[model samples]
Target: MQAAAPDLWHHYGRTRADTDRGVPDFFPWIWAQDGGPGSEVLGDVTGLVLADLGAGAARHAAHLVVHHAPARVDAIDASAAQHAMAGDLYGHLAPRLRTLHANAAEHLEAHPDEYDVLYSVFGGLDFADPRRLLPAAARALRPGGLLAAATLGHYLGGAPAEPDVQHADIPARTPDGTPATMRRWVLQEHVWTKLLDEAGFTAIGVDRLPPATSGARSADTLLLRARRHK
Candidate 1:
């Protein structure tokens, strides 16, 4: 038997989850999360089966369930802490908003053709290996189903995004306050488009959403939209 690694995301969103317990009224795709395009990017989610990949705390998924009338929105996150937090905050919306604890790629692979819409807001698309995750997403979505995700347009410290598939070891903290690093993929627009096309997606489009304001930590967001071939 082997012990599991410490949850690197254990402390993420903890402070906000405590004060803001209500389901969000809006969903932002930009990195800032303050303003930008909302759920309209997913078109009409009404009565649609959707999943929020790498949904941290599931605020956006909760919003869709409460305000958009989705048939169901599975908030999927690999982090045990995030899954627990999502349940604690919006478990009352069950049946519509279901929180799942699983790796995004593994979950999608397990539930082929299970979702009509799949979107990640700086979530799985940023942290997971696109080679595995994107193909799994393509297999998991029904033909012509939408796949939307927001990711970094460049490195956070004003560096250019990678021209090819690559992952950066970004700093992270473990559950017991130990220092760690996690892989984050921040690829250029054409790189992402090419990857999506190769992964069985069509009509791929990427939009660069510049931050509302400039700052050291602020980086542009790449909003990607595509559909599985019908």
Candidate 2:
């Protein structure tokens, strides 16, 4: 058997996790994470079973559990480091907030029709292949369940988003600091809409959220919302 691949996300959000352990008070869907539509986009998750795909440190998931009163929120991240960080930060929320270690697509596939709401904040929807992840998401959500995700409207360096389904080899670093790369999908709005439609989602909507401030790394965010067919 071959050796396991390095965890490319091991270093992500490490610095912030060390200092800020409190659940977030707001949920921003924009690339800046400074401001924009809040959790209202998920539309009253109270008493709903939800999951945050690729939920990093699960700050947003914790916020929903604490403020929005979701019956339960599964914070799923494939990265061991991210999963561990989420557990360490918000495990106290227990019963209501569960930190899960699993790939977004695989997890959704394993639990069909298990959620009332599924969401991602520049998380799984950006890093995973929509052809697979979107269908799994549709299957995982009960009929009429909501799917919300925030993704890039364009590439980080001001490049235009792909008009077709494609993946970019973005730079990353392994746990040992070795240079590596990861696949990220930055498709145009129409492309995403088409994928969602084909994946058995209905009432699909994509909203563009401009960056709060202009900068070299700044890019617009596309807030995607859809409903599983009833």
Candidate 3:
């Protein structure tokens, strides 16, 4: 029931504890691109149920526990490879973090109105079809819920694109030790915000951060926050 292809996350989860150098902070929530903008300021999450969709390597979700003290954090990802990375990073926090290997969309369908905050860091939210994800996310959130997510901003041009069929990139490596590439769905600003509105969220805000330049090209990202109006 996975929306993304199985091969997309294979190489990413390959590192073991010995072979690993160190798991760098990918999403700190401390305002770094690697981490998030820090959960304490994100919303009222402490002592509340929270889910981190697309919790690659489980950094952000783990951070929630160590820094913010959420009662429980479900770090869900569809790729076992991704979970492997999570296992390495979590060390002894496996039970506390509750990392799960299942298609995020499928998991959400079974648990309704269960989360106070549902967040993603360029995970299933940006890669899978929003038609399937946003509605499910709305269902997972209780009334007056919040979705704090980070996703890809407009890439080439700010044109509306279909949600079901799109492509995105994952940090993949070939067996020969070269960068591998894959594409999944990435929504234009209007397309994504509208989907949230249709899914029953309101006051949706997408905050665009400064672009990162590599020689000539620039990478743009957006931090989105939406509330489920009960």
* Number of residue pairs clashing in candidate 3, backbone atoms closer than 3 angstroms, sequence gap of 3 or more or interchain: 14
Residue 83 C-alpha lDDT in model 3? 76
| Candidate 3 Cα deviation (angstroms), residue 41 | 5.2
**Candidate 2 structure, TM-score to reference:** 0.99
Per residue, candidate 2 scores C-alpha lDDT tens digits across 107-151 of 999999899999999999999999999999999999999999999
Instruction: Score residue 209 of candidate 1 by CA lDDT.
Output: 93
lDDT of 1 at 125: 95
Q: What C-alpha lDDT values do all the predictions have?
A: 0.96, 0.96, 0.72
Q: What is the TM-score of each candidate against the true structure?
A: 0.99, 0.99, 0.79
For all candidates, the clash counts are 0, 0, 14
Write one digit per residue (lDDT tens) for candidate 3, span 63-99.
7777666788899988777777787678567565788
Least accurate 10 contiguous residues by lDDT in model 2: 16-25
Model 3 regions more than 4 Å off? 1-6, 13-36, 156-183, 212-217
Question: Which TM-score value belongs to model 1?
Answer: 0.99
